[model samples]
Target: MGTADAPVILVTGASRGIGKAICELLATQGAQLVMAARDGEALQVLATELSAHGAPEPMVAVIDLADADAVAGLFKQVFNRFGRLDGLVNNAGVLHEGLLGMIRAEDIDRVLAINVKAPLMAMQYAARLMSRTQRGSIVNLVSIMGVNGAAGLSLYAASKAALVGATRSAAKELAAKGIRVNAVSPGFIDTDMTRAMPEAAHARRVASIGMGRAGTPREVAELVAFLLGGQSTYVTGQVIGIDGQMVV
Candidate 1:
């Protein structure tokens, strides 16, 4: 049973990169974390470290978001164990880059399943729990590519764009219940995924950004924290970009 002062937050894709950074910062804020990801070992390691550092030992749900049943079960476990859900961060997603004509059906399905459907389903369950208290917040991790066009990232962009639209609709539907939903559209960020880009391409991308550098996962995590916390109580149904003014 969690107290009011110690809110319970469920963060998907919480094993590494941006997800890991979000969990790390939220731990410091005294949040009782429910970490979900396919990497059980990594999740356990993070749980151990956070516990050792004085944060509450996070509840780990090792799940493949591609499996709809597994995603639903995760929420069931969260409510059964914690009795409430105060916040949710839909950070689990896949970026499959392929040109429109060359893209395959299976690839599109996989990307949409993990990126779009998973978040929507998570929101459905989270909203049910949130409705009980009439207070909760959700932050969906969208992408700047969803807002702008990218040549080789058509499928990824489509999935993200779908999430962005859903974010607004969900926010409106849940707002009357005192549940706030919003999105974070991250631009090029310094993460394991972005680090794999070719040197020339990465350099060109960075040079184009107004900041002359890629944003850090920690920077995005900070915005997520603000939205989930009390500071953004009046903010809802909005998508804020953390792209260093690149998209502008």
Candidate 2:
């Protein structure tokens, strides 16, 4: 358990990759974690690992963010368990690539539900709680695909672009309430999702980066931590990209 005075943070998609890295880093800052994801087993394993390492014991929430309604349940859990939320990382997202003609209706629904709707609703819930205390920070995980526009990822790009807009608008609306909202738009991060891309597509992505390599999850997490932490208190309504110079 963290100290009673420790900050409480809710991280969606907390079982893997950038989400997992965010949890680990935030825990080190003495933040009590509400780790939400679809993978119960993975969440448990990570909670155990963090606890063993002397971080605060994490509360795991196994939920499929694709449901969209799950965001309400997650916020309820947070309020009932912790009574307050000091930070939120909306990191749960899905990426389905297909040529425009090949895209299915189901794919659009699933991707939008997870990537856009859930996060927006999560922000709604978090905003309510944070407004009460007059303190909070929210970091939305966006992507360069949304800004730079990927060929076969039109739907995914649209969803993320929507979030980028939401981030800025939320920041404006929430600023007077002492709540902040920002986005971290990463490009070509080395995660399981990206690794699963077809070889040629993956190579093409890497070849466009000025760094000549994909970024790491930890690097993205570091930026999120900064935005959530006290280091960047004056920052909000911004979409910061960590793409290593997308030369494309």
TM-score of each: 0.97, 0.97
- Per-residue error for 188 in candidate 2, Å, reads 0.5
Q: Give residue 167's lDDT in candidate 1 (0 to 100).
A: 100
What pairs collide in candidate 2? none
Model 1 lDDT, full chain set: 0.94
Residue-wise C-alpha lDDT for candidate 2, range 56-89, written one tens digit per residue? 8999999998776777988988899889999999
Q: After superposition, how far is residue 126 of candidate 1 from its true place, in Å?
A: 0.2
Worst lDDT window (10 residues) for model 2? 1-10
Once superposed on the true structure, which residue ranges of model 1 sit more than 4 Å away at CA?
1-5
